[model samples]
Target: MSLMITDECINCDVCEPECPNGAISQGEEIYVIDPNLCTECVGHFDEPQCQQVCPVDCIPLDPGHEESREQLYAKYERIMAVEE
Candidate 1:
């Protein structure tokens, strides 16, 4: 599943740089995770980097955007292809 930033986010800016997929971005009040870019670190790390670095534990699983491992990998590939 893609991760999402909760309202509990402190906006400390700690998680932005930790995201390998560049999914996290600064929103009006908190950091937001772009689901289209979020791979839950499937192709990049063993765990979600943003979640790992979040200080307030504000990053939560996006139940609305639940995806399987195969879907996550495909998302990663699509994003990486654009970069290349």
Candidate 2:
């Protein structure tokens, strides 16, 4: 599953740089993770970087956008492809 930042985010800016996929971005009031680019760090790390760096623990699994490990890897590939 992808991760999402809830309203509980403090906007401390801690999670922004940690996201390997660059899926996390500043929102109107909190951080937002683009589902299309989010891979839960499958190709870059063992765990989600945003969740690791969030000070307020606002990052949570996006239950509404769950996907399998293979799906995550595919998403990661797609993201890297665009970057290249």
Candidate 3:
């Protein structure tokens, strides 16, 4: 599944840099995670880097965007392809 930043986010700005997919960004209120760009760090790390660095623990898996590990890997690949 993709991840989400809840209202509990403290706006620490830590998670934004940690997201390999550039999915995290400053929203009008709290930071937001774009589900389209989120791959749960499947291609870059063993764990979600945003969740690891967020001090308030606001990052959570988005049930709405659930996907298997293989699907996440494919998403990561597609993202990388576009960047390249």
**What do the candidate models score in CA lDDT, each in turn?**
0.92, 0.89, 0.93
- Summarize candidate 3's per-residue lDDT along 1-84 as a digit string, tens digits: 999999988898999999999998999999999999999999899999998988888988999999999999999999999999
Q: Quick one: how many clashes does candidate 2 have? A: 0
Per-model RMSD to reference = 0.7, 0.7, 0.5
Sort all candidates by TM-score, best to worst. 3, 1, 2
lDDT-wise, the better of 1 and 3 is: 3
Clashes of each: 0, 0, 0
Cα TM-score per model: 0.96, 0.95, 0.97
Instruction: Give the per-residue lDDT digits (tens) of candidate 1, residues 1-84.
Output: 899999999989899999888889999988899999999999899999888888789898999999999999999999999999
Among all candidates shown, the one with the greatest lDDT: 3
- Once fitted onto the true fold, the runs of candidate 2 whose alpha carbons sit more than 4 angstroms away are none
- Candidate 3: count of backbone clashes, pairs at least 3 residues apart or interchain: 0
